[model samples]
Target: MHAIEKQKSPMQSLAESVLDAHTANFWLQKINPLWSVSQPLGKIIEIQSAATDTVSLKIKVNRHFLMGKAGQHHPVIVEIAGRRYERTYSLTQLDQYHVLLTVKRIAQGVVSQWLCNTAKVGDVLHFGQPYGDMTVTPEQQPALILLAAGSGITPMYSLLKALDYSNKISTQTITLMYWVKQHADAAFANYFESLAQQHANFKVHIFHTQEAPCDARLNKNHIDFIKDLSNSTVYACGPSGFVNTAEQLFTSAKNFKSEAFSLTPIISDEGGFINVTLTKSNKTIAIPKGQSILVGLEQQNIQPQHGCRMGICNKCSCNKVQGATKNLVNGVENTEPRNSLRICVNSAQTDLIIDI
Candidate 1:
């Protein structure tokens, strides 16, 4: 009869645990085995005008920086007015050591303003590894469907350009549906038109919500398009509520997928912090309201496996054995025993028991 003893990790200790600063550093160095792989740190090399307010930046990354997938996003860390800020932008085109990122100048966007107003051609920008799983695949099923809104077309542009560049245009049929408030608001509409001129497998459908004589109206025709897509493989990206109606439109459709790295929402959880126990690590900790549990844990020097900070990536998915959460946008509260929550977007409102 051998006796088994349980050892607690530093994050597991309720009270302050003894840890040497150097040991923590050493442990962090070995934490994610593949974290050492070189990632991009872009430097603005050139900027090209695409539209009135839209600018396409040609950034030069070192060769060691990993090139992103056709539809992946990379976090851009910038400093403005002595304050640090971060934003994610999808690559418009992937080139060797120079990926093109196009951004529309928002009226009051902090980082976008800085990049548009202050950052010079030679300014260095810290970039994270390419993240996001919403990518187009050549081997993917036929009749690919892409839906986007405003700047959401960033990822779609990458995928379309990649396919055309690789001469894989004949592999799959694609129907790209884009919507904008006005005709002037459309980005890369001319570009899509130019590509459609030569490519036979791609088609573009633009819906100008405010203008007359547009090809498609907003009401129910979009739903009809969703139904017509055969062997459907959906890839959508955009504002929070832009496409919420699709869940019902494609309830019966298969291979439905969406990607949104829109922004870090500031919705208040209102409720106070609650305690949570990470079962795998045997850790107990208090989680604050109005803040993502995953982020709060990271602030306390606790790192749960995370990829994209957005819930769409599912890298931060954790099993919820107890407690409740209100879906910020959908209002569909999630409270199932074996169900998983994307901790990146979910906040703790009550004491939770998690099987992390």
Candidate 2:
């Protein structure tokens, strides 16, 4: 005999046909902003000043949200003036249902400015699944060097908290070198100092580069004070130039991992322009080679959806109909047709057609 299968009721069938999931969710959100059929949402619970130009928000996430690893980043979506804007920020999981997001206001950053100044307690925000590979593991070396610059300290703070929660801090030697423009710009300084005092194996150093008698930036000379580079695991997060310098200085470490929040696109020596055809928009534009497609498009008054322009988020990804492109970050070239390309990190090497 065949097994019986449950069938949908007439009302259920009618509802599914008449109202899509998005329409239903729109109604659901009217009752409770955090309520969603499938979208992950978070309600801001607490707000505090983190630094001179930074704010920390404690958010309570809904059941649909999936907590990411300590050092991963989550795409935050917010609506402003009926237009949705997305940005990626490193999240620190406070508990099973809560996470902390820190925002450093940028001069012209719409999302950051809104998050830091306009967002209020009880306001809800949407989130995408977390993505990143710079995570902590049990197999890592006992000696860990965490190097952070400016807003890059957020992920390092998360990593440290995770290590402390797992009771691993007491067994390992951890050193944190955090760089900021001034002492007032340093976030979580007290917390890190207290942790270092509580745990003898932990050490914290705050370097202010723009203060009186500035401390030199990351260079080979700084490595003289750090012990056992050959046996230590080095993790760095910062601007492209800072991360690049760290990589060069610590290349001899046992293991090196890094993530850059901002990147300066590498200009190719072969200076030329390639025509890029947008299939959906029915437009063709000439873009310079070796420059990111996103930048090129913006220069031509074409703005594609983008976030965290550093290649950490997939907001700028588009389907390539045909093209040869090079990844600016890793210098990998691709000529395969019908492939997904991230415009923010990839430059067109040849005339191309893309689904934008």
TM-score of every candidate relative to the true structure: 0.70, 0.85
Clashing pairs in 2: none
Candidate 2 residue lDDT tens string, 187-248: 99999999999998898989999999898888888787688989999999988778878888
- Candidate 1 C-alpha lDDT tens digits along 92-211: 555565788788888968777777666778776767667777876556877778888778888888988887778776667778899887788788899898877776777888888767
> Local distance difference test, per candidate?
0.69, 0.88
Tell me, by TM-score, which candidate is best. Answer: 2
lDDT of 2 at 36: 62
Clashes found in each candidate (C-alpha, N, C closer than 3 A): 0, 0
